[model samples]
Target: MATSGGVDVGAAVIDCGSFLIRGGLAGEDSPRALVPSAIGTRSGKNDVLGHSLWGLPELVDQVVDVYDPMAGLQAIPKWDVMKKVVDHVLSKHLMVSSKETPLILVEPSYMWGVNGRAAAAELVFEGMGLKSFFIARGPVMAAFSAGRSTSLVVDVGHQGAFATAVFEGYALEKSKQTSVLGGRALSDYTYQVANEKAGQNGIRARYELPSMSGATTEKESKAEGSNGVVDSTAAVSKDTAGSEEKEKPKDGSQDVEMEVKEEAVPAAPPGEVSKVKPTTVEAPPPAPGAVVPKEGVAKTFSLDSKKAFYRMQIVHDLKQSALSIREIIETPDPEANGGGPAQTATAAAVVAGSKVKREPRPTVYTLPDGTELDMGQEICERIPESLFDPRLLSDSKIPGIESARSLHRLAYEAASACDIDVRRELFGGLVLSGGCSLFPGVAERFQREVAAITPQMFKLRMVSPSLRQDRASAPWVGGSILGSLGTFQQMWMSKQEYDEHGAMGINRKCP
Candidate 1:
């Protein structure tokens, strides 16, 4: 956690996720800071301060297991790390007086089990010395962020994606479900596409660089080199210094030609030579998959040139691919629906029929060492479509359970499991909230898919956070809003109550 220069006595809210942890003072509209949800072990690197480091860019390239505090359906898997994470969030990021102020912890709906809830309570009140606390589900927080009491929250996170139905601030547990696919899966797919392309083009295949920064086009670097930016002073220096210069041509026709002859200076005695100024030329950029050192410490780091393409272009393609594949799956086919000999054939045809509509969008990315990588329409638009269409997945050997669920199916199942009376309300209150939901067309596409399954008579109203950037941290915003309210004060489990009832009291107090 990185501390900002401010202190607030009010309760602080933390929205924890697999990829990022968003937190701030309770009364703020949005979180004060967002950090990667990873903790780094003690290493010799300057980036890893003391025993652990959180959300620093240098730690990403470090040789340590980046520990994710939350995994699978369980929240706060590593108890010690979770304690440190909470302490860091409250004391550093939020800059709050933990022992004096209250705390609001946001978590996934699936993690509301008795054990996880009690452990979180113990960690907050007992472990971190926080005085008061309240545990809120991510979906419920998302609903509150949207200013709605009832909603079906779809969170596309790093570990997995979930669709949870919340009615009047309470989660409908039966209908809450998650799939294996999420932001991490998409990043993996991007890596796969880049590696495959590299192999096909005979380039050394490697993972995409997570970050890089300098030339925007491939031609620009070549042009700079050809224009004599490299060693341009050599020719002029030959004439100026005590060295040989070329003779002028006879056909110059009144042109002044100055040609200097070479002169060797006498060698100096032992240790008598003066050191010439060191050249300040920039070193050539390393190749796509090569290690280079910084600060001349001899500790080198590998660079993956493919990162620019993945971050700028491949991610957008993934969003487009998800939208396209989802539309195909949800669109019903009459022949595939019927039971006949041709039914199987029709279903196969329909599954294979849909194609990604490609538009010409060229992208140019600059590498940190001033090199550029150019991507064409095909390369820029290509992503693993199989995530949404399992048939498109090349590996048939994968177990059915592991590679099965699609986005459309997950949404349908969640909506179907809701009570019949409020099923319409659930459909209409569908809220897309998460890092992945920040993709341009995801919300519109999600609304369209839900509208397809819903009857025309009931209005299908889907909404997202008002600010585009807030979509990723919607739950944090909700926690901030909820914790600030005067009515919410009664919900916090104070230190006095925790002392009397112990950690188990959280299940009853928060409930």
Candidate 2:
């Protein structure tokens, strides 16, 4: 059992999917913990938890075997699954904290107003032990490691990218901040373009990246590399391969470029795939079932590279425009009305030299060692060139960091209230957190832009969190420091006090 005066400790940070819980027995001991957000259960064994195998002779051992009770929350919150998780964790750690030890847990800011959290927290405390404390808001915790006083925090994870700007350690109101800025925007942006490119021709393929999956284990591409993004759409069958090759004019001919619409290109048809070579063969967006080589053919009509180039141009516009909009929104002023031609042109820029005049693009997301994401940044870029918003690929980009764009522009209302100037000797250090700052080039790129935008007299630098550490940990970092002090009666209230004065009292103590 954990005691305040003893070294025993139980601490956890819970995100949407997983809980990273760390525990130690004494002041000298280190925390041993893991956060597995998923609950996998065998089908048909049972649909619920605590369903009672109490008297069944055949179920005696089965009761002991059940792992996660809150397994299926697709239909319900499955608070029971959470209970089973704690039990399973304690069993592994050999701790007697479930009924005697105290716990300090963390969660997201959005959970504050929900009634479910109150009940959930109660049940967890009741099941484990009444001596517990809660500290929700992990992005704030991760930012703590940055050792900064004020900064933007971007927490990009599996389910989505979330961003938060904290000033003087206070979590600002959503009304005071703009929403629709983060990773889901990136994923959605990437998905629409990928979908259009793959659907171009008649080849239907699966995407490699799982929907709502791969936040932690995926490869390090500030965005997409083999580990970052996969084209499951290319999960081609043996028959599918035979068709792609058969469709390619059987003769090995580089002279014949078979052009198709942005919608006609199949997803990575596995034949000789050179790095996405630019081709102008546009064949009137091939008829349904009309087999066409995604790249070139041996015999027949020369494809229109203009259309392909047109697609690439579209991608350029989307990336640049989206980038501009995010910058404006990130630094918005109360009197600001909207955007202008330069902002509009950012999305409209296209690559030159091709038969089709289109916007240019940056090299796509790269692997850790810096390999081009070979996925489809180019192809994806192409689709956005021509499509307007409301068209799916129609990159309106206003609410999109989620959108794409460039750093070029000349505009300002009242400069952002939060843009605190920093002298290198004092506050040049910017602390980053939130869910959106997770994009690859954000920090480095933002630094370059900020320097360009600011008066040259002030030098600036931006930093990202240590990889794999949660942004939410920033607050926990501060909490960890707070946790390791004299037995201060001021910071935490006793559970016994809660028994007398209740939940409201608990908030008052910490609030």
Candidate 3:
């Protein structure tokens, strides 16, 4: 709760992006509910929506079709789904009635031209029946979060990146620049590398099974001895082991060896030949909503759409935990041989020369099947390099990747688009905000790259927050600050104003 004019404001702030929707009360240090910006609908039933499918168990047992309402920071396409999401957050997470709370909605700069602000106003005032609300641009909020009224805010989020120049807390919309490179693109590249490695090493997908009475303890066990009960040893093995013989069950179901702790069996009586053997049973069908297993034999298995989606989640975690950017870009020495290109050097030597220094040890990520992946520096550094050089993504299948400019170029161009008097200030107050910008060494690298292209007379400075969480949710933090200010209490657009002027009134009121 926050106070304005000695009264409890009870304002709510929602910052919804392509990947996540962050919602919380105003004046809070961080968002209370950070859920995925997606809703799941069962196949053939698009009207029925599931709010939080991030939990694995909920996703199992049904073929869910995941849809993202905010895919590219544009105007939301699925207003119905968006409304449900808002309700879920407000009532379920924030425990506040929509009609009682004043809301601040954050939107991107590009959406301002497309009537996105007015549509959002309609959703808040008419759809949700909120009393009052304000629409704030994401870049301006990010600048505010960084404690600057004037800054060049570069936000690299899940779907795309944008560089906006702000002056006195107002975004210079004409000077805004956008790029296709973002956190999801880098995560996709990391997934490619990890998938290839898993294929080569015969790694499988593992999942934690729900606990049942009389279940075995937390130890590696064989799935065969579960006696028709689904246990923690269930695993989905990939078809990586070439030429391995696989047993086919008579029921036409795949037989996968479950990795679970072996149950103790009574010793056979009087040394008679014990006929007990590992029971072979029908494996769980490789279908949508099938539970992932803990371990399995080295055999081929089809990856259902659900499994692929889940694996992407694992890759996303690995990217966040293990990825790092190089402080300095590595390039081959041009004057190695008599001030000429090293044409006589071998290809391996040239590649070695261009390689950035590796970390002392590779990051080890364990898969669900207990296989450790050695995510070396080469993979970690190369994925983020695409942000600096769009050419690195020329071969990638990601749409619009080739059309994107590097982050440095984006910032420089955005500042150059502004007036000459403000260009220096924008350069001096560069701010990095968003999940992608939280990468270690990203700010330093951005500053270096911008300085290389910037004019000699200009001075460049980065005003990024020291805390990672602050940087990732900078816009939401800014909105939280603005909503709690006593001075800002008069700024919200009331329901009466909306009724008189219509949805388009938000532009005049919020802007």
lDDT of each: 0.51, 0.33, 0.62
TM-score of each: 0.65, 0.46, 0.72
Alpha-carbon deviation at 430 in model 3, angstroms: 0.7
lDDT of 3 by residue, 36-125 (tens): 555544443222222214322322333344444654434343555577767766654566678888888887545545466777888888
Candidate 3 wrong stretches, greater than 4 Å: 1-9, 43-52, 56-59, 73-77, 109-114, 200-305, 328-361
Candidate 3 minimal-lDDT segment of 10 residues: 248-257
Give me the runs in candidate 1 sitting further than 4 Å from their true place: 1-8, 44-63, 73-76, 199-390, 393-403
Which candidate gets the maximum lDDT versus the true structure?
A: 3
Candidate 2 structure quality by residue, lDDT tens digits, 92-205: 332444556544444443324344445455555554565655544444444445765454544432222334455555444341222232322333354344334343341121
In TM-score terms, candidate 2 sits at: 0.46
What TM-score does model 3 achieve against the real structure? 0.72
Cα RMSD of all models vs. native, in order, equals 18.1, 18.5, 14.8
True lDDT of residue 47, candidate 2: 15
lDDT of 1 by residue, 1-511 (tens): 1123443357778876656566678778766555444443324422221111211122223324233445443344455565655565555445556676777888864454777788888877767787788988888899888988898788776656788888888887888777655655555444444334434442221122334222123322232234222111232223333431212100000011111111122111111111221101001122334343332122222233222212322333333333222223223466433322112212332222353445433354332223444433444333323434445544322223265565556766787897778877776676787756654445655554454444444455666675656777788888988987989888888889989998999988876
- Candidate that would win on TM-score: 3
